[model samples]
Target: MSNLQNGFLLDDETELKTLLFEGEQDHLTPSTSRLLLESDFFVVAGRIIGHSFLNGGPCLVGLSQGIIHVLFGGEPETATVTESDCADQDVREVIRMLQGTKDLSEEEKSVVLSLTLPWDLPGVTVNNRHWLQEKILLHAVLERTAQQVKQIRRGLKDTGVWEFFSSRPDAVPVLFPRASEAEITPQMVIDNINWPKDEDIDEDILSLDDHCLIMSFLRRFIENGTSDILKSLLTFWTGWGVVCSNLEVEVIDCSLPQSSTCFLTLKLSKNHKNYEDFHQDLMASISSAYSGFGQI
Candidate 1:
């Protein structure tokens, strides 16, 4: 659900101007400045992370303390703020105590203003800016969503091409496939005299060459312990290219981009037994679905 449905105030489309103009009109400038006055804390003890300033104001926070600090566009220099250690109570306990509402005095708020905030991050950049500030907040949300999708896919244990493809709603057609394809067998390659993966062929002979090439590629997937990689590759493949296709070829991957991968077994029918027959069918179907992926 979207943030608006849950009544959350923090949203990408939230307008800072509307927030700043909420109350009294006379002291709007000072009140707006106060609303923007966010401090960065260094430690749980409430040492100043960086002094807060108005948006578009001079003071810019750095990501780290040691980096020569400067106020906005000035030459890089050292920060003037001093760091201090508070008494050893956990900071959250202090926050709870303050929120209990035993009626805080005006003097107390002024003295302990720094204690109210959490941590002091070094600096803010366009990458970390707010939505009403810049567009980074939206991009961060998308990055987080992508990471979650990857995480969910990793948690599944299914190894079959059909089961794996069905699990993800967003994943679709894989490589091209034939209508009545038969289980692919090693004998099919050994029995078929001339196959496509071979170089020389007469125009009259229909060879299983492409099937051999695909089988070899499948063999490479397992040659280097890339079952999980094969799964992802197949996920994109079957999810988008072929609807419900299966293969029984070996994979011989040299190396993988990450830790885990997957492999599948392709079963072919009697008439569709040879590699070339399946390869031709797959190529034709895939070309119709996604035109350019196979060419490269």
Candidate 2:
């Protein structure tokens, strides 16, 4: 599943372009490359996504909501297409122009006509501008990539999950989540942890001041960390981007932070005199793990 996820998200070996999709990060749509389509790449991508979900592995995630709607058999006309969905900057500018109440300037008219002419759409007029805007948007977001979308549908069918997707509209977000929906929160991390206990007396480790202080530092770090930090920490602790069911934290006698990814355990040294030292060590540890440098 990890390999599948990487295969879809990583760059192509020959061209350094993304393997299956394109556009801004997290707003991806299926690639419309003729070469990729001719090779049935989208179909295979769909199958990988379905298989990953069925096997309870990582989701493809970070697909455009509009594209996800079309992928699951929703009408393209009904799918919302904001400027963000249009990868072309000029097209996005055109979309923004269309949303205004002001009449198009001569230059703006020329810009709009240039785009629409290629698609055989009519030039904008006072009476037809609204309709033309809608058409232009649809063309930019969906029509241009129609074949790729169709192949994805076919691929999903091959995996025998097309019916499930078509029937479960709610499942769309789960399989291909929006960027905001996929963000990891500090509470999410805190909730999944299994704090250590005093083995000698069977007492709660939280009762110890050093353990409490270390845990406080961990919480503060997570709360203040960037999204990359959260993801790196998760990967360092669990050997995966997603959180584990039972993350364990143990206060130890060492000076640096350490993790056993196999056990989902983060070992924090209680020797730090202040949060600054703890934060630095923790950052180094997670950064090393994220970069495949192993524990520092």
Candidate 3:
């Protein structure tokens, strides 16, 4: 739904069918029995198959179709060039011509097809029979590029860090890892946390991961009447993993996210030293949320 809201074209049922299988007119069938898949293609194909099984359905035939879509559509593809443009030119030079694209615009994407696809044209077809065999090397290069791209994308998607930053690319200061744990103070952690962190953090300071884990704990505080959460945060010694019954932490009052930017203000115990430092870091995190690097 977020992807839809973000203007991404969701694959509809028809498009999904076209993606998974040959259309009725294409008359293609799966060849599952005697397969000699390359190592890289096999890995990509396996992932798509698994994704389809879990998301699409349990059918094996559907899995095969899904694999086919991922191989060609692993990423957005370039446009094909028309046959006339590169008809008389050297195919190698034509390839060299298109290699500079850091980002392919819709118009230019297919332009390279004019060079390579025509290699099979009537006049050129007879002369390149040998080159066609050599095309195996070209196929290998493309397959390898696609494999590498999938792994890169998968890694980024798995880490919430990617979502956090990609949603606000201009937030450079927040990109740095939280200051070393030893240098962080409990008050510093409270100042910065608008959400629960991913790990049990020790006292010196709570890092970004700690905030992600703690967000949930603070929600009930909002429901309860106590408004000052600062003292509760300081109860556990730094570095405690799971909460202890004796020293369980709780939130009092807090403010976050009247907007997408979380401007958290925790009233940790009064008279804490480095109070100004924690405020500065909280401001930086808010600035990051707003896509502005906080003022140094």
All candidates' lDDT scores? 0.26, 0.76, 0.31
In candidate 2, list every pair of residues with a backbone clash.
none
Model 2 agreement with the true structure over 100-189: per-residue lDDT tens digits = 899889999998989899999988888888788788878877988888888878877888888887899876777777767767888788
Error of 1 at 214 (Å): 5.6
Predictions ranked by lDDT, top down?
Answer: 2, 3, 1
Instruction: Quote the positional error of residue 39 for candidate 3 in Å.
Output: 11
Stronger candidate by TM-score (2 vs 3): 2
Per-residue lDDT over 1-296 for candidate 1, one digit per residue giving the tens place of the 0 to 100 score? 01111122434585322221111111111111222223111111011111111111111111111111221212222323111111123332333334444554666444334432222222222333222111222121222123322222232212122233345423321211111131233333234212233343332333455345454543433243233333233323433211133332322222211111133233222234445554444334334322233332
lDDT tens string, model 3, 1-296?
Answer: 11111122325654331121111211211221112123232333334434433342221221122222333343322322222212123444434444443544444434544434544422123344344323422332233234443542343344333344445645422322112311333434444344422354443454443343344333333233121132222211221111112222322223321122112233232222243443433333333321232222
TM for candidate 2 is: 0.77
Q: Against the hidden reference, what TM-scores do the models get? A: 0.19, 0.77, 0.18
lDDT of 1 at 143: 21
For residue 13, give model 3's deviation from the true position in Å.
51
The clash tally of candidate 1 reads: 53
